[model samples]
Target: MGVKNNIIAAIDIGTTKIVAIMGEIDSDGRLRIIGMEKTVSRGVKRGVIHSIEDTIGAIREVVDRLQAKSNKNISKVYVGIAGQHIRSIKNRQFKYIQNGVGEISKLDVEEILNENFRIPIEVGEQILHVIPQDFVVDKEAGIRNPVGMAGRRLDGNFNIIIGRTASARNIEKCVKEVGLEIEELVLEPLASSLAVLSEEEKEAGVVLVDIGGGTTDITVYFDGILRHTAVIPFGGDIVTRDIKEGCSVLIKQAEALKIQFGEAVADLVDEEKVVTIPSVGGWDPKEISFKTLAQIIQCRMEEIIESVKFQIELTGLHDKIGAGIVLTGGGALLRNLDVLTQRKTGIDVRIGYPDSTSKIILDEALNQPIYATGIGLILNGLNKPIENEKDLGNDKDTGSKMNLFKRFFGAMFDTED
Candidate 1:
């Protein structure tokens, strides 16, 4: 493969699949998708690495394929992280401006953000992101950017995302084992929002629901600011498992049936229709009604929707969600899912495709919800600002690689809290 430092890469390690994408920023500042590949995820469960070897194998295979297609050597990559252990909390920090220098500088802002990093967290947990929601200068409130303004005290309200330290360490280990360097670790829901959400939708208050294989990731935005994020343990795989057990079918057959014939609403199905499943060995075929399958799917989907509703209610902005909910990810493609979500939540709902951004144009087959995280990862990587080599580690080769990702973790979290 050709060595190209300008090429940026991202790996989305999902429960059902791992997607690797390579792209470069064009003169027009658009991210041009050059190569992308995906493979069935192994050793990953609910977006967390379970077996490092298996996860590394999957990552290596996808990366190799992406490299061959793009003809670019992959040295480092940005990766997405999500799982049941992910949670968010609101935090506040205050920094006193110099007595003589009443004007707040960028250093003051950084100091407030740095203070968030020092907040006490659970013993086994680590802060993954510290997003500034709004800034307050002295007694003046609702300040968006306090820098360049004069104030005696600067207060920052932030949304901090925390996850199990072991989970993150395992992910880093997987990337290292694959002979790749970690650029940054982005939360999966945030990446999905970057892929599918519009500025208008965010400003009007929207909830981005990413229903992947093993978990349903939720991100809430109000007035263009991120307000809340959560992860539900149940996802598409659990629904498939319900089908497998409910229909007495094999796991593979269950997944295929859910994808091909599943409906989110049982009442929408005709009870007269039946799907025949071929039996294993010498056993006879079993006949199952369309109603039965829909009923099974509906039960699980309703549960998931209720969980989403609970999280939305917790935000206390449920009634203010003017843009309602935008659903993406593999499970969002289910038949009548938008309709079901709308009915359950009593809010406007739509299927979110990763096509909102004009920065990248992907293959028609890859323009689906399943590729949202991967596309967002590539977009994030392309937009990441360059950091000084000194800010990276001390080793020359490793420092340069680490520099590519330092800004993402340090500055990306400076997002709307």
Candidate 2:
């Protein structure tokens, strides 16, 4: 077993499933997966926790399984968040140097970034992330790193992600109910991008589309900077609903049919072939044309592609997407989805599997697109510095109140013990 401090854990609570993973960094600075567990999610919908007790039970179950398998006590974890309420807005802020024509310092940059947190948001909403897109010193623009540069004024553009305040608090409540401390709450799209996108791809301009069970997450990167992020309310679950309604089958049967026989392009299906679907309530099996099933699936997929295209168009850099689109998440496994996406969007497409930058020899299952966010969470946790108690007080957009309770209750429990 590795040193306790060296171990990093992450929990990805999605609409369809909950995943808990534990990893440790090797001597070469590469991350290795020590243990992992996942189970169907019961209390979440579209990436948001709907029932706190149910969500807590799911998290506790997975965490216990992970701990038992790795023989390590899990105390802290990095978690991912997404939902229909998640949105991105662009804002700019600047700071005037106290002394004219002075070298830019870290404090100057921090001040500009901090200004974003003060920006007024809609009632009941809070900022989740403030990503600096580029810095401008005086008149010079497009400066990636402005430290040590002499400038009288520093200006910066940021992409701020915001979500409903209640949504975030619910997630914190669930984690804390399971007797765990949250290391940080990372946006699911950003975490997914970190796991699967290459620096070259980001530099050349690319769009990552993560189609999960309940929501579709979109992240656009250009010139090696995060440009935009969004979460559509619909995902693979909607497609399943369409199948169930269209074929008059059970929900589970619809999901199984979508995975086993669904195709994105109806024209590709041979009308001569048919599939027999077993009936519910001990009813006789029914025969359906394969083309009908493909048609139902194709209609829903095309709508999803159009939604993705609309998001890309909003960035105004759709034409500059040199690396095209990369799809990940559980929904990416739909057969021939890449081909359909390319046909609809007129751009190249590929299924995104998390790159092996971690250097961990993973099982074939972990290498799939569905695990990209989980793997990326570990990488993000290891690369990013841990937030101190003081920093938590300043991050109002997340669940800072919960952190306060954590500290107070933690101390109370310690005194009792």
Best by the TM-score measure = 1
Each model's lDDT: 0.84, 0.83
Full-model lDDT, candidate 1: 0.84
lDDT by residue for model 1 (1-417), tens: 111355788899999998998877777777777888999997988878888988889998998888887777888888898999998999999988984878887656766776776889999999888777888998999987676788889898989999999999999998898889877788889888888998788889999999999999999998777899999998999999999999989899899899999999999998899989887887689998889999999999999999999999999998999999999999999999999999999999999888887777777888899999988877777655454424323455444333332333334334342
Error of 2 at 99 (Å): 4.9
Q: How many pairs of residues in model 2 come into backbone collision? A: 0
**Clashing pairs for predicted structure model 1, backbone only:** 132-417, 133-417
Per-residue lDDT over 1-417 for candidate 2, one digit per residue giving the tens place of the 0 to 100 score: 222377889999999999999888777767788888999999998888988988999999999999998998988888888999998899999988875548887657656776888899999999878777888999999987776788888999888889999998999999999999887788888888878888788889999999999999999999878898888888999999999999888899889889888888888889898889876699789987889999998999899999999999998998999999999998899988999999999889999997635445466768889998988877776643335434332545433433322321222112211
